[model samples]
Structures are given as structure tokens and as C-alpha cells.
Target: MLRKGLILAAFGLAFVAGPAFASAGPKEPRQASWSFEGPFGKFDQAQVQRGYKVYREVCAACHSMSLLSFRNLGQKSGPFYDDKYPNPNDNPYVKSIAKDYQVNDIDSETGDVVQRTATSADTFPSPFANEAAARASNGGALPPDLSVMIKARPQGAQYVYSILTGYQAPPAGLEVPPNQYYNPYMPGDVSAFYKGKGHVPVGGFIAMAPPLEADKVTFDDGTKSTLDQQAKDVVAFLAWASEPKQTERKQFGVAAMIYLLIFAGLLWVSYRRIWRNVAH
Candidate 1:
């Protein structure tokens, strides 16, 4: 307990220094329903799977989740988790997913760079080889990595959902520039676009165009593909990816609390017995 508390304290201190501390999205993220919200709440595996599908089909082309590997998809409570496969590396589903990706590797015998089929152990490869290339590909705007993005933002999940779904036509006379788009949820000062003395519009300029659309990616579960649905699903996957161990951590916390309660009760009973025969 002390160790966990210390770690949490250290984390809190670090967070105070983190960029997220000063986060200032133009508008508060629209709240959304989530399965993993409370202490005993758990992830909906089916929903996570659908979210992963959305990420793979749409987001993967531009964004990278390099902090995660294909094998993580098979970890306990993960999108492809299977009870029969105790180790994620052995999960057939994860293997199939990894096999589909072509990763850059060195040929051991020839000592040459080569494109090889990926394995479950490999991390998700970036779409671009370097930051410069990534920025160049997207009109000098680099796509941020999705790993830990949920933890890095305030109201993490809601913020991402709003950004994904909150795109709209630029407010009148905003004078949006080439390669830039306006989103009400994007964080930035748009006062420059407010020459007419209004509230500067409740948003900022973004390089990213609207990514999700209705029917963009078909869900295997036959769930209707609405713009809202796609945004929610992908956000869920990002939520899970942000902390793969969150469910396990919550479970451990519950067990620890229960144990502490039992121990405290026993100590109280012992103290009462010891003092019963003594005078005040």
C-alpha cells in the first residue's frame, strides 16, 4: 500500500509538470457514455474489438500507436484476448494480425534492410520513417502518435471523441487558410479570425481534416456505421490502448481495499479485547 501510494505521489508530481496540466481546448469535450468509468467497471471486449477495427481501417494510415504491439491485442482483457492462449504471443488471432503487416527489418544472413512479415512481438510500425517525412506527407503537419494520448489530455476520452466528431463549416468570415481546417473542439486562439468583435468562435484551426464519416468502415459485428459510431468506437480503442493494464489495476485496487478492510477489522477487534480488562 505504501509503495503504491508513493508511486502515485510521484506520478502526481510528474503530472503537475506535464503539458496536460495547462491544456486548453477551445471547448470542453462533449461527454460520452463509457463502459469503464468506475471502480468496478470493466471494458466491453466486443466494443473494444469494434474500435480496433475502426482504428486499423481508418486511423492507422496516418496515426501510429508505436507503444503497442500486435501481441497486446491478445493480452488479458484486450481486443483479441483469448482464454485458451495464456500468452499473447501465442494467440492465433494476434499472429494473424501481425502477419498482415510488412515491417522493415535487417536480413540476418545478408546484412541488408528488407521488408519482412511482422510478428506478434513487433511494435506497431510508424506510417512514416521520420518526423520530417511525416510532416511533409501531411502538409507540414505531423500526425500525433495515439499511444497514451488518452492519458495526455484532460477528459481524455471525451476530448478525443469530440475532436473526431465536432468538425463543422468554418464560422462566417473566419478566413480559414489553405490546408487548415476549423474544429470547435481544437485547442488554440482563433481571435485572429474574429475581426468582427465576436467570441472568436469557440474553437481553433487544425491541420487535420475530418477523418470519420458514415459508412467509412464496415463493422464486422453488423453495427450501423454512423459518424458518431465511428468516432465513439475509435475513441474506445484509444482509451484501451492508452492503458492496457487499467482493468487489471482497477481489479487489484478493489482487492487491496478489501484486504485492508479485513485487516483493520481484525486489528480493531484485537485492540478492543486487549483494553476490555484494563481500566480507563
Candidate 2:
């Protein structure tokens, strides 16, 4: 996220300091650039499932993406397209999980309030009343709803992957000035929240330390336990989290592919017929 402000405003505007503070440290895991694409090596279905387990077991208590529905776990929707799509009903891994009641807000004459409903629908509930309230509740650190996080963050997959795996220290001789916030991915003190409390002044910085650890969530099959591996899994999960429309997109993609192939064949035949007479 980027921030704008006057020359002297410093950290008053949250945006300027938001990213810098958010990225105060390189606490995430390390990942390869290719993980952003589909069929990412080591970033497979199992890894995503494991990452989800980590979220549910460890992080969910503090952070909640109420907007996400259990049904979404079985679907695939994101920037990248892969053959392994989520199937809520058929997949044994997810089918056994019980669905729960979902709640939503209805704007009625009585004003804004929450109402519980079925969870089978595609909608989600907001975790907080608004941005300000959310930030206040979470120690001045708004735990962003993960439902659309993969989409909201620019180059979200890569960013999330980097964040997950970026917990290392800065290279030799790199010193964080007393006033400036420190981060690996963020370029400088540009974080808006330089003061005791404020938003991230830097554009690409965030303060929430990396949550996942190496081999934290081991799968049934033995796999190497490394931060990079964890990063791959978490990023895949986030990519799926961001887009729950994978099945629909894949269906459309197959149809488009067929149409293009048929069109190409027709063009080939037309060209042969048109040139046949000239050859004779």
C-alpha cells in the first residue's frame, strides 16, 4: 500500500507510515519467485491445506477472516489457473467438515445489526464495524480480513509469500536509524507511522510479524521442513483464499480453448480451398 502526505506532516497521515510500520521486520519466510504462478513446486494442495491448518489452529484465534466461508475451502479461484481445484462435496479431505451457520448485516429501519443465516451461500461477514474499530481492537494493528487479502495486496501472491518467508535480518552493515522503521522488503523509513502510534508511512511496509514457522504444520507425508516450504504452502492457500471462483474460471477457460481450436481448423480449411484454384 502507498501513502501520501505533506513535506512536514511526517507520520500524521496513516498511509505514509502504514506500510513502513507494517513491515517493521523481515519476519516472513523466504520463497522463490515462481511460487506466484500455477503448479508451483512445493506449493501444492497439501501445502495449502497445511497452511489452512496453521491458520485454524494458531492464527485464527487472533485473526479472523469472517468473510471467508467454509465452502470456499473446496473451490479454486485466483490469478493463477491450475488443474487441482477445490471440490467441497466430493473431496474427502473437505467433505467430512461440517458446515456452520453464517451471519450477515441487514440495513433495516432498526439500523445496522447482525443476523445469523446459512453458511452454504457465497457471502461473508465483516469482522469489525469499520477500519477504525478493527485497528483499535487489534492493538492498533488492524488484522486485515484474509477473505480478499490475496486480491487487495498488489502482486498479492508474491507479497504474501514473501511476507510469510521474509523473517531474516538485513544484510551486513545495514542499520535502522532511530526514527525510521526497519523492514526487508520495504525500501526506507517512508512508513507513515514513525511516531509512537500511526499508520504505516511507507508504501510497501507492514508491521505484523511473520506468523508461520518452518515445519510448523507437517503433512501426513514426510516433506522437508523449511521456511521456504512453509512460504510456498501459505502463498498457495492465500491465492486460493483471494479468489474462490476457480471452478467457474476453469470451466470458461476450457470452453474458450475449444472455440479457439475450432476456429483455427476452420481457417486452415478455408485457406487450403482458396489457394487450391491458384495452384491448379
Candidate 3:
């Protein structure tokens, strides 16, 4: 009877402590619906185009998308893809886009390296020459290459959207460190590092300042340039960049499932027919 009482008490204690423990971690990112979320979902082309604009006008200064080539902008699955530019290499718009940046190339006659207008074959260039330069520019925090950022994070697009919109002044009793801005969604907090130094509250901070603001970029489609709207558009574009073939893959999966279901039904019918004349 004593053992039973001890076990019951232990369980009661666990039941009481579970909620407290569960709430200890960083706040879970709020989930946002995506146009390309489910099996039947397809990306909204206009949103993707708007997202590309936001990336180009705002985020491009700090982030490099080295994995993507200029021609990728005209890909069939990409936001800027169009029937007119079936061959992205020869697309006039793609060529014009590439020309916006200067690329280093060796001169055919002189064999000397020279900066020239980029072509569709060229990948997007990094803003800084190297990691040292990047770190020097940003006060020791190296800006991450954004090519696969959405895939690299825990919640991908949702987490990014939260981070973009989550910046806030530290609460009344909390002390934020210099050069570090308060953002609850980012990992690591002032409290964790400042044990006994002061009354620093628990919430992560980031080095990159808030990049988005209202009316930062004029949308061609006339969509309101609210912070949330810009964040959503950019996240959608990043999602596409991470998995351009998502729609095709989902379509194939649906087709495969349908075929398997039909095949299974036929097999079951055949087995019953074949065993009809025999005893189990």
C-alpha cells in the first residue's frame, strides 16, 4: 500500500511539473499558411514575383544567393519564368537582369582579368569579397548565405517570417547587451550569458538589424507594403528557392498513391476469386 501511494504521488508531481517544463523553451513560432503547403497547393506566381522584388531591393545587400544562377530567374518553376523565355539562356530579360551586376572575367586577347557585365550563366555575386570582409562589415557577425536558409532552419519559412517581424524592445526588467538587439524568436538570450551580472531577461537577440519596414519598397502590383505582407512574400520566395520542384513532386505522389490503391483493390478481388473453389 505504501509503494502504491508513493507511485501515485510521483505521478501527481510529474503531472504538475510537465506544463512548467514544457513552457521553458523559446516560444514556438506562429504558423502561417503558405500557398504551396498541401498536396494540391500551387505557388501564387504574383506573390513569388513580389517576394523576388523584396529580396532584390532589401535583403540582397547583406545576403548572397550564390547557389542560384541568373538563368534560374527565368526557370519554368521560378517566379519570373514565362512562356516567352522558354530558353532562359537566350531570354532578353534574363540577359538584362544579369547585366545589372559586373562579373570578373579574363579578357580573351590580353589574358588579363577584367570586370565585365554579367551574363545569364553567372551566379549572383557576394556583396563582400570574403568572410573576413563580411565579418568586418557586420561587426563580427558573419551574414549567412540565404540560398538554403529556409531549409536549414527548424520551422523554415515560418521561423524566418517570425524573425523578420518579431523584433521588440526588451521588457521593463530585462537588460539587453550592447550591439545585440532583442528578438524572442532568435536562439540564445542575455540572461543565459549574464548570470549574476545583472537582471537580463531570457530572450534571444540577433545582430542583423530589422531590415523590413512599411513602404520600404514600392510593389509593382500595388500590394500594401506592410511589414507582415513583405515578410510573407519574401518567405514564399525563399520556400520556392528551397524546393522549386515541390509542386511536381506532390503531383507524382498523388498519382502513385492512386495507382497503389487501385492495384491493391484488384489484388484483393483476384485472391478472393482464386480461393473461392478451395477451403481455407
Error of 3 at 245 (Å): 1.4
Error of 1 at 271 (Å): 0.4
User: Residue by residue across 78-98, what tens digits does model 1's lDDT show?
Assistant: 999999999999999999999
Candidate 3 lDDT trough over 10 residues, lowest sum: 192-201
Instruction: For candidate 2, write residues 22-69 as lDDT tens digits.
Output: 634333333456433543233356666766666665566456666766
Q: Tens-digit lDDT track for model 3 on 1-280?
A: 9999999999998877554333233557869999898898878889988998999999989899888888887887678788876898987878888989987789899999899899999998888888999999888999998888999999998899999999998766555666778887787745544333233444487889999999998899999999999999999988888777777788899999999999999999999999999987
User: Which segments of candidate 1 are over 4 A away from where they belong?
Assistant: 1-25
The true-versus-predicted C-alpha distance at residue 59 of model 2, in Å, is 3.8
Candidate 2: residue 208 Cα off by (Å): 0.9
Q: Which candidate model has the greater lDDT, 1 or 3?
A: 1
TM-score of each: 0.89, 0.58, 0.83
Clashes of each: 0, 42, 0
Native-to-model Cα distance after best TM-score fit, residue 251 in candidate 3, in Å: 1.6
Sequence-dependent TM-score of model 1: 0.89
